[model samples]
Target: MTGMKAFFGTFIKEIKLLTRDPAGLILLFLMPSAFIISLSLALEGTFMTVEKSVNKYKIAVVNNNTGHDGKNIIDLFEKSGKLIVLTNFEKTLLSEERARRAIIDSDIIAAVIIPQLDKNRDRRAEIKLIIDPGLANEVGSFLQYSLQQYIYISEIARLNIEKNMLQKSIYPQTVEYKANLGTIASNSGDFSIKKYYALREATTDIIPTSVQQNVPGWTIFALFWIAQILGINILGEITDGSFRRVKVSPTSERIWLTGKIVPYFLINLLQVLFLFALGVYLMPKIGLPALEIHNTGALVILTLAVSLCAISLGVLFAALSRSSFMLSSFSAMILLLMSVLGGIMVPKFVMPPVMQDFSMWVPHGWAIDGYMNVLVKQSGIRDILPAVYRLLIFSLLFFSAGYLALKSKLGRI
Candidate 1:
């Protein structure tokens, strides 16, 4: 009963100390909100717009053959939403020399040259393509594939027409010619010609908005800074002998440490809620997409788990540091390095493959993944179970190590 009273007393003391520090509270709450809003605004016009616009290909189309087959190919390209076919008054305007120059000097991504079709030949004519050097392989491959699609459809139509003509014994040249035009116009499937953005998962293609990315990322970052401040205060208490006085009291070390951690856990959890609230309601009023929480219950569970991990990290840092400067420097380096590796500064989808694999090793990465699952993927609590379990395991390890270290140090003193 006496130990329980001591625990509540120590917990209240820690809470009072934190409440006394207004600047720290502001750093924990307001700074993340500011960072989320500013970065979301800066990225809104540039990255999102570029990602959406990069799919369109501007290609010069030079049609030299007036034959139905050749004109049909040009018409196919003109109708495709993916390709912007440049039309010049002269069919041969994009000659070999001009086509090369156009690709090098300006907006053209590639050039398609349709050779004159021989009316007497039984074979299909070859199409030549001159593509820009940088994107030559990709653009050229797409053009070839699209061309093949048209050819395959036309060939199928031609075979069917020949079968009918053979049965009727009335093989007219006009019939085959009509089939080619009709096939190009009527028989195309929804084949994606150019992919603008690569998908991370086959199940969903929606990239979370800039707000969705920044809010969770910077919120995680801010939580770490909260831990740093907690460590700094712990260092201060040690220097000033406050921890020594607590050691001499009736409170056991375990209860005292738990008391210290619980308040900070609550504070960090509240901080996350404030930041997310700003992300949801306030950000959209200023022109950003409102933060969408697909599962509020899952978000709460993840946030609670993340807060415990961060608080445990703070306890570990406080246990190891000998001075305020050491605590600040080490905490900053640790958190910032984790943030970079864990996809806080840049989205993980855009990170290098090596970094993406490396991110899974950090608790920050697990937390971010959990938040992204809720926000972008519209995941349920079950979907985030792996991340939540990882976070809990990290907390267990950090707290256990920190407790042992603190006990050894206090035992010597």
Candidate 2:
């Protein structure tokens, strides 16, 4: 149809305009690529949390007793098989000072200090438990309980041996131990855990999310910026009466509108592919972990959806602005604010609940989440379908706004 000719004509005009603007293309491609690489490298180190699991934790035991009881308690801890037990420091017996240093240095989670137990219950030596403040509360409690159960067992074994030797001894039946607070003092000394890093038990298994956020975050940022340029271009054409001329031409308005979006949509896709490729292949060469993709097919589809959203946002930008300066300033301000809330500048996992919900409310949030699901999480197409749907909805809303503007003289300018 002649309508198709109008569409192709507009599409080609957009392309020729793009080709004439080499500086703009460089700003689009070169600037963002450099920024993505640098920021990704910059964020390689940040708040990293280790998961709390038995095999992953290490503990130390300091036995000053020199008696079989201390050895027996060590045996109990080792037998539990919940964590690794280190009884010696540098091939020698572990000292209290050394054990404390180890806990501070993050070599071990906690240290159990068993003092010499007196034969008389009234004059018994107290055991001490010192822990890293960063340790999970449950880990501290678990260690304290383990110390209690087996320390008593050691005493009972000693009493049986003494009874076998004399055959006519009656000891008190009750077990009484005093607990104090502060530094790991005597066994009867206070059981207090010191604060080290105050780490949380909950953690993700992948690379630091701050770093994971950079590639996708900045890429989405770059893609959305296309809206600013796209909006400004539309405003210029409108002010110059280019679109007015098109309205009077034989071209169908619908086809002409679609043509306007496709060029920038293709540009957005290329930007995404270029940025993501650097994240995957070039990052590891610079000493960071390579970005991993969970599903390639899903990634391709999601990229298209994100590109569509960016193009839609461009249309909305053009619809709202009456001048080039207005379009530029408005799009930049709104895009950056959205970036902050969308987990582009800050990863969502680290954000508080209210901000996280706000981030999800924005279209940029959905686009980044979809990229993360594909890049970081082990997500299938089915898992990402909701994000894709959300992006489609955002596109629809933006296009509707642009359509309404076009019906008025503002978009025709």
Provide TM-scores for the models: 0.65, 0.63
The TM-score obtained by model 1 is 0.65
Q: Write the per-residue lDDT of candidate 1 for residues 196-289, one digit (tens) a residue.
A: 2111231112345688789999999987777788778766876887788877888788988888778888888888889899888998799877
Q: Write the per-residue lDDT of candidate 2 for residues 1-413, one digit (tens) a residue.
A: 78888888899999999999899897898877887778766755552343243225788888887556567667778888887889987798898888877765667777887776555556446666877643444566788777766645444554555555454333343433322322222232222223222122222222234445788888888988998888788768878877778777887667877887899998988897888888789887987666777588998888888778888888888878878888899899999999999978777766888888898788778887777666654467986788899988888888888767865754334
List candidate 2 stretches off by more than 4 Å: 47-211, 410-413
lDDT of 2 at 374: 64
Worst 10 residues of 2 by lDDT: 196-205
- Top lDDT hit: 1
